[model samples]
Target: MALCTPLTNACKRATASVPSASATSVLKPCSSRWRRGNATVAPPVTQDATSSKGPTAMVFMNMGGPSTTDEVGDFLSRLFADADLIPLGRLQSYVGPLIARRRTPKIQKQYAEIGGGSPIRKWSEYQAAQMCMILDKTSPETAPHKPYVAFRYADPLTEEMYGKLIEDGFGAGKGGRAVAFTQYPQYSCSTTGSSLNELWKWRNRLEGKRATGEVDPEGSIKWSVIDRWPIHSGLVEASAQNIEKTLATYPKGRRDNVVLLFSAHSLPMSVVNRGDPYPAEVAATVYAVMQRLGMKHQYRLVWQSQVGPQPWLGAQTSDTVESLIKKGQTDLILIPIAFTSDHIETLYELDKEIIGEAEQEGVRRVESLNGNPVFIKALADIAKAHLQSGSACSPQMTLRCPGCVSERCLAQKEFFAGQAKHLSAFSQ
Candidate 1:
């Protein structure tokens, strides 16, 4: 959920690279080659031939980072070119690449520092697989939930993931159900919205394109979205547990006095001004976690990872940390509130850059929610509710931003919401 803001432009659709569909689509296990220390888990449950309704695809959606230094250039380029993100207008083709090229070295260095890559891919795959395993038992009607990771940028891009789904026998006239579960707990037009738009774009492009492989659009995968769940109780409990673990490191006398700084990636005020729901939803998560902790220590919601010289939503995290220390509030716990997994933002930026600069033993960051059993259970609970409810998407997803002028957003929303017609048919 690391967002980079640059010069702004009116929202318009941008072209994306078509992934090589010819590439073999064998599902790979979590690779130890990426320096991720987490142990590999078994794959998600497969479809049962005996079950009438099974083989559901649970696709985890997020803005992914490069897995290695070699991928930073293309990752940044795809990110900057996304109109749903940076929105560089007609110059997107020219400006996006230039910016990505310029920033590649620095971003690669950051990734290099954080165990040579982002561990998000590893955690996402593990979480998705684990959640599906729970779902197979808990929601057996939709048994055998297979996990897929769809990154907006980096490897396993939207196109690649969609192709894998087709290869896995999801679409191509053999109708099935798939859930686009956004990994961002709080929804943003720049984050989850962008990912959905990409998914919708490919859904149209890849399905029913040619006579040789024509897909009956009506017979394609029936889709539903778990768009946002910023305040799920399980999520709150997991976050509270992590905070408590961090607080225990402090001495008894000082534990209750330590300030809690809950930080999330900042958005450009331009997006904020467009009535994007992210800022409010992120606040909701912080509030819920604090309440679950019984509001013991003082806390402030802060923003981080604002790139370029634009007006971004703040009280920036770095400035707040420095100010708090100056005010003699050195005992602080910094929590990465919005993101569920560890990435450069947490590993390099918070660990090496911010806390490293502070040079205070009193300052500490709570561990990320990655592979947290409670958090993984929360994911399964959310999916189970969605599966049983037969809803196309959350009601909140139907409305577009007040300032949204992009036709892509409108079409994408309508397309997903329209799946309500198909959900009832499949649930039986």
Candidate 2:
């Protein structure tokens, strides 16, 4: 992808005004600095000084991990309690805490091994900031793109993010544009869907409540979604480029035959049976990446991180690695196809558990797209296209799964899709 020209005057002014600070200090979320107060008074972001068409919130949504070992319990408790992710039915409230408590010790140890915490929060912040920098240049019509990350099951939770937005004046009886950009390139009810539903829940509670399926009333946040970009060219190019870099590490003679195992977090078979689009979407990403690479090597899409006793999506990533080695194919490259950044899944699960247990020198994993320039540019491209299109959400986003029964899905989809009526007001 060609690079956009230098930052516009508005972007330059925004950048020039920033205080000289350490990179770590600059990348940190501003949530700590600007806390929500009892009074809803805020400097409304009706228009940004940078540009007349400005002050857009580029909120990246993802499933977050605990930042430290001590947070493991709370994290797991929330994760298990989320009915969208783990449906325990009537027993959810009773059984969720029990499962979280029992699993805390083991999960804490996993966090301890991987540098005492998950690096997801750091990478997510960096990715969001970089993408917004690019967006400010490429899409000045939506210039002054402010970055915010709303994570499920962790700090900077959905409510916290919405609060920060209002505190910074995105929405509090004032209209402003915000995009809920899911970091999970592909859409899944268990992942992206869960995040969106939680976002909708908060938007209702913090802002005024509305009919479950009604559009936002006047003077509310004008929202849109970049719901999924499973097969975007930039995504494929980035994945293929990373694979090429990893493949280059092998001996020249062995590189051609090295198996590429594209792995994703496994979904429960029940979710799959419910017609969740995740599996097919993940497969589409892998296929797109392979096609971009001209199908240079043998590859298979495998699943990982199965929890509980229930059958999950497979052939499992670990099993595939062991089987390939048993067949004397020692050289392999595991690619995390489903997620953009590393967390417990990529760091501890794939690295320590899978590769470490395999005891094979030939097996390795590709680096996550953390702070990857190409991937960041791709994010900007996706956001730019969405903002320009003036679509409230993807056409498919309004559709429910064939086997879907959740009223939350029905209402959330309707609420977001309904924003179509208000999008033009912002775009103009």
Candidate 3:
């Protein structure tokens, strides 16, 4: 199948609005610098200066990781504090921190195993830069207004990033500004929703504190949010193609008999039972990729990296592997669909735990399609489409129909509203 292309006409129209001479003018260079233990220091751009138009703003969404062992407590506090993340009411106040503290040793150990810390923030920054490069190549007209920026839920970029962008003169009517959420091929409330809520809160705080002289006038620029891309066919095909490549590396005969295990992060059964479409969405993605591959190989969908005591979606990948081993299955191919890139879940849980189990179970070969180039290109394609079509500002369409309130949505709504009220009191 041919790769999907962005809306060219729309891009042309958007570009034509900017004058040729002005478009060719030298743009203020933006630089990002970081020190090992110090906050990032970016070269300051003159906020008062105006180019032909304003800068393009892009925010990459991420589930921020804990940077220091000491931060584990506060990190869990913020994550659990959000009702959307943990729908358990006031119980979360105590449970959230407790869980983080308990898991700190394990989590810290995992981070230690793969360097000294999680590279999510750094990877996100690199992705933003790569995305900017692609956007520039695809649409040079908007190249000057690089809309590339990274933000995290529990770390440095915080609400402060928004303020910085606004200070550097990015907002509505100033230039072509856009926000892009970074989860490719699949979307989950836990990842995407949490990041977006952070952005919303940051925007609200920055705009709210305007009276306190904390707001940047240039920041008042209009901006649009681009958050979701549901199971695009391009991504599906790319993933399947990547899997085929991985299969090729194995002994020829073993390839055909490989057990194709598609894995995703498991959510609590309460969430799924309540009507969250996460599981269904993940299924759809698996089906799409499987259909594209045209494979008759034995396959199963399994969940990995489950947390909290609440019942999570299953069959757990490790448990499933054990069952398959008993049934005489040997070769295996693990496809991590829940995550776009390798993280703690992928590096430790799936790689260390599951792979170790597979080896112990006598599985001869185990393969993974995590961070394959085709998959990365698929992500770049998704981002390019949004920018080229000027659709980055469009609201994400709901997977569920209106009035369709799955029991999950209803429960989640009630949970969120109550938490919102509670959080609101603290804000006031």
lDDT for model 3 comes to 0.52
* Candidate 1 residue runs with Cα over 4 Å from true position: 3-50, 208-216
Off by over 4 Å in 3: 1-54, 67-74, 145-152, 172-176, 208-219, 360-373, 388-428
In model 1, residue pairs whose N, Cα or C atoms come closer than 3 Å (at least 3 residues apart or on different chains), thus clashing, are none
| Model 2 error, position 240 (Å) | 0.8
lDDT score, residue 392, model 3?
Answer: 25
lDDT of 2 by residue, 43-151 (tens): 4455645566667888989988788999988988888888788777799998989988888887788777777777777778888887887887888777778888899
Kindly list the per-residue Cα lDDT of model 3 for residues 124-235, writing each as its tens digit. 5555555555555554544444434443435655566665564444432122344445553445555555555566555445542332233332323344445555477656
Write down the TM-score of every candidate.
0.89, 0.89, 0.73
Model 2 accuracy (lDDT, Cα): 0.78
Relative to the true structure, how large is the alpha-carbon lDDT of every model?
0.80, 0.78, 0.52
The per-residue C-alpha lDDT of model 3 at residue 419 equals: 28
RMSD of 1: 8.8
Residue pairs clashing in model 2 are none
Q: Write the per-residue lDDT of candidate 1 for residues 240-357, one digit (tens) a residue.
A: 9999999999999999999999989898888999999999999999999999999888999998887777688999888899999999999988899998988777887777777888
